[model samples]
Target: MNILLAVLTSAIAVGGTLIGSWSTYLFQRRTAERAEAVNREERLRQERLAAFSTYAAAVTELKRGLITLWFRRRRALRDQDTREELQAAQLDSDRLGAAAEAAAFRLRLVADDPGLRPLMTAISTHLGAISHAADRQAVIAIEARFEEAVTAFIDAAAARVQ
Candidate 1:
């Protein structure tokens, strides 16, 4: 009888230990899963912010490039070389427009400011007018106007953001 009692107690002790270990394993697995989920969410948010920043930077670069080219060409430039550089700048501006549209749609960047859309439209129109001009003289006449418009845009954009 004593031997039988000892055997039963030993078996119960082993069973209890196994149950405790399984419970601990399950708890650890759940905690790890929760942590992974949180990490995934954080990474996704950061990716979105990064994408928005890239789009904004591209747009700024386009404006800066066009403005810089305008300034460079403004200084007693000959008709032939000025026209060539203007064409190149226009192409860069067009690419930036496409990127802006994509970013706005994909990232839902429709901000409260009404001027942003019009500014973009104006830039596109200015470039288009320059591109369609029949002669260098026509384009050269509007070069200063184009430069002023872009400068104003930058100023207004800064104010609006603030």
Candidate 2:
């Protein structure tokens, strides 16, 4: 009888120990998973903010270019300052496009929204047209299109920003 009681007690103790170990393991796993999930969310938020900064910088440059080009389009000798601004804007646009176009530019930004490309292309085309215009009408066309494209891009980017 004593032998039977001893074996039964030992068996119960071993079973309890196993249950305790399993519970502890599950608890630790859950905690780790929660921490990992929080980290991921934080990383994503930072990435978005970075991307926003890049896009905002690019848009500001683009607006400056548009202003310069528009104001100088009718001038007999294109303003040297405006020309410089155009060049700077172009460089900023390229840099932003590289990132807005991909993942690397964001403070850690992501997403591949292709709709933004057309606005950039339009701005470039219109700006280029101004340089090659043979007459006032041609210049006007460039002015109109450039403004339109810039406005559209700004609107879109603003929407995305908010």
Candidate 2 clashing pairs? 106-109
For candidate 1, the 10 contiguous residues with the lowest summed lDDT are 104-113
Worst 10 residues of 2 by lDDT: 100-109
> Per-residue alpha-carbon lDDT of model 2 for 54-85, expressed as tens digits?
65455445545544454455442555456666
lDDT of each: 0.62, 0.62
Model 1 misplaced regions, further than 4 Å = 66-81, 105-162
In the range 1-162, model 1's lDDT, one tens digit per residue, is 999999999999999999999999999999999999989877766655554455455555654555545554553255545666676766776676677667656544534346656665565566556545545576665555556665666666555434
Error of 1 at 27 (Å): 1.2
Let me know the TM-score candidate 1 reaches against the reference structure: 0.54
TM-score of each: 0.54, 0.50
